[model samples]
Target: MGQNTDRRALVRDRFDRAVGYEGAATMQRVAAQRLFEKLQERMEGRVPLRILELGCGTGFLTEKLRNAWPQADIVATDIAPHMLERAQQRVGEGLCYRIMDAGEPDVSGPFDIVCGNLVFQWLEHPQQAIARLGRLLSPGGILALSTLMDGTFQEWRTACAVEHEESGTPDYPSAASIGEWYPSLFNGGWETEACVQTFSNGRAFLRHLKETGASVPRAGYRPMQLSALRRSLARFDAQGSVVTWRLAYGCFQKPPRAGVFITGTDTGVGKTFVSACLVKAWEALYWKPLQSGLAEEAGDTPTILSLTHCAPEDCLPPAGAFQAPLSPEAAARAEGVTIDPASLALRMQEPERPMVVEGAGGLMVPATETLMMCDLAAQWGLPVVLVARSGLGTLNHTLLSLEALRQRGIAMAGVVLNGPLNPANRETITEKGKVRILAEIPFQADVSAQSVEGIAQTLPSWADVRGGA
Candidate 1:
């Protein structure tokens, strides 16, 4: 407990000097620019757009926000007084810097925008912070923010765990859970958008966190010993200092919103099967924007239709299907077919029924030269259901896939575990892996037509399978 306080204080002291910190300024500037661009695009010509930033740190983001909206009134708040002092020094006019905790933001008024960068993990009650932000925002106002996700510091965590079993900690919350925290946001009339970004290594990565004043420990969290920390750092060095972080960014718009986008784990994990089941249960139309590795006639759309008993006319294929059993890009190239994601989306768009579209391969798999499956999922904006094979090795794969989807800001509708059940694997995946296995489909010799009927009979209802959807 004492250590936690000291660590927090040390972080506060480090960040107090962060505004004047050198070397890392360039990276911080670049990140700040990207964030500013996103906020600027959202703000448009709204005169004097009111902007509120939680945990403004040394004011890097706050300064960027001020520059982007010189006419806007920006209020930057942080729990660390020294950090707030530095932030005040950085931003003179149109920006107000205050020392305030995000969990209990003591600012006034319904702002046009609430923005924060890499600050959510330190809070004990992020959902409450989000709800407070929601209450603070004016009608139609949006909350644009970014934070360190579960995969962040994975290398460091692993290294620490070997020497000190209890030292390493669990990853941060999934973006889906973060989204689900505010059920009222969706059903109570609000539109939300979220995504995650992954970073490559530890020294430079940790340095970035410090520079941005985002390295503060949680309020009541314990700290590891110095010897263990040194050993962990040494291990990271031995491993070529490979480090990674997952950052989730999101924006929630108040009222009068459209729909949400959905994405899942990797390919052949039953995304299509579960999507078909969802469609049948909801009486929704089913669509597959792009189908790759089609066995001439045995395509994903057909398989889904057969499973759901949808009409043949409802089974839409890709704009250009290829015979080669390769990735969509490679397959299209082999078949000399132009693969346009937009064209494929246009071909699959249905005006009636809640459309369930299946993606090809994993989130990061390239569809075209420039687009990935995740890019398409983000573009479409549907609530996603990730399908994972129900067995060993799924824990890592599911977590990684969830991390990928989170980074892309895709809304996941929970996970569906297909294939036979393995008790050990399921326990590890759900407990240690921190993923909810919504449903488990036992292994069977045939997922084919002859046995699909039997499979359907055993299959649980969509809502029940999806854990009440």
Candidate 2:
């Protein structure tokens, strides 16, 4: 907590000194313009959007938003007071201007759109921050932002590498990782572009960063000596270097309606059964995004079909089905098939009935090299129903799963405890994890359709699910 506070202080101090941001923010301006255009495309036909803009440095993007949608109730905010003041001076009144962290917005939400420009990279926990922001959006609302990505400043990085010196540039996340940050219920993706900016020499590049207040290095980095820095600068200048700014523009939207994303503490936990109960209870659509282990056993979807007696059309096809009995990522690789997470992110169209999405394995299990089962849940923007065994080690596993979901700000419908009843385990999870005990399904000698129907009757209503939805 102290470290995070110190880091935020460092960022605030740096940006406070960046009085020249308006003049020096070339790439920032370009990104703001493009971000606005992209947002315009997404928001077409939707009027009077309740827009909340994060890190509105000097009002570059805020101005565009204002001019673009005068009807919008624009709430432009920043962490630095100077930047907020500068933005107020640029765009003047009507739009609410506040000095606050994007991770902790003081304003109420259900905002039609939440946006930012060239500011996401500065967040300490970009993933967690995005999840928190997603909570602020209205139904069908979007969180749009552009940020510096991993490949940015490669020229300077190469120069530093050649000079055997450290570079001050913070390591940015890749587009794939950024995509994973969004809540599973939200249909989110990023598009990348490399915008090149030329500077006279290495000193100029360093100065440019300072002018834009982007000089904050990653925490715990040792600064190079003046001599070493000068040498690296020389190397950078000698290389015919023009810096490449790898930018990723992302858009994540809260669905107008969604259901629960069912996952488990472990692979063998009763997620399939819990999902079956929910589908049967709500008469909802079921989608198993990635199915593995065809070689070993029948997948969850078929079992769900038989258990729920759901129509074939109600069972949404698996986005990626693999023959190997492994994690989705590993299974895809073994089968020589590339699965795009964006391709897998399908929400029901005008969902009249709820949809239950069942994930294979545990939350941390990798769906891809860059995405986890949890990331898919966050992306889909549905409230999660974390199922766990109700005995012995269940306490730790259930708490961990709850914490993971809380950290991502993924809405939770609650935990469904399965197996032999452990009142102590149930009490501990409810008290320690601060999660509702959605259901307690005891062991059944014959787990059949009749039993499932009885259990489904005990589950919460659609309104309960939508409460978190």
**Model 1 quality (TM-score):** 0.51
Off by over 4 Å in 2: 1-3, 260-280, 283-469
Angstrom error of the Cα, residue 377, model 1: value is 4.3
lDDT of each: 0.62, 0.84
* Clash number by candidate, in order: 17, 13
Give the top-scoring candidate (TM-score).
Answer: 2
Task: List TM-scores for all candidates, in order.
Answer: 0.51, 0.62
Measured with C-alpha atoms, the lDDT of residue 91 in candidate 1 is 83
- The true-versus-predicted C-alpha distance at residue 263 of model 2, in Å, is 18
The residue-by-residue lDDT of candidate 2 on 1-469, one tens digit each, is 2127888899989999997788888999999999988888777567756899999999999999898789889999999999999999999899899888876677888799999998878776787777778788887787898888898999998889888877889989887777566654565567889999999888888888998999999877899998888888888889875899999987766765667788999988888888889999998899999999999878888988888898898888899899999999999998787888778765665475788989989999999879999888876777788999999899888899988886665767788999998999999999998778889999977777888899999998877756533
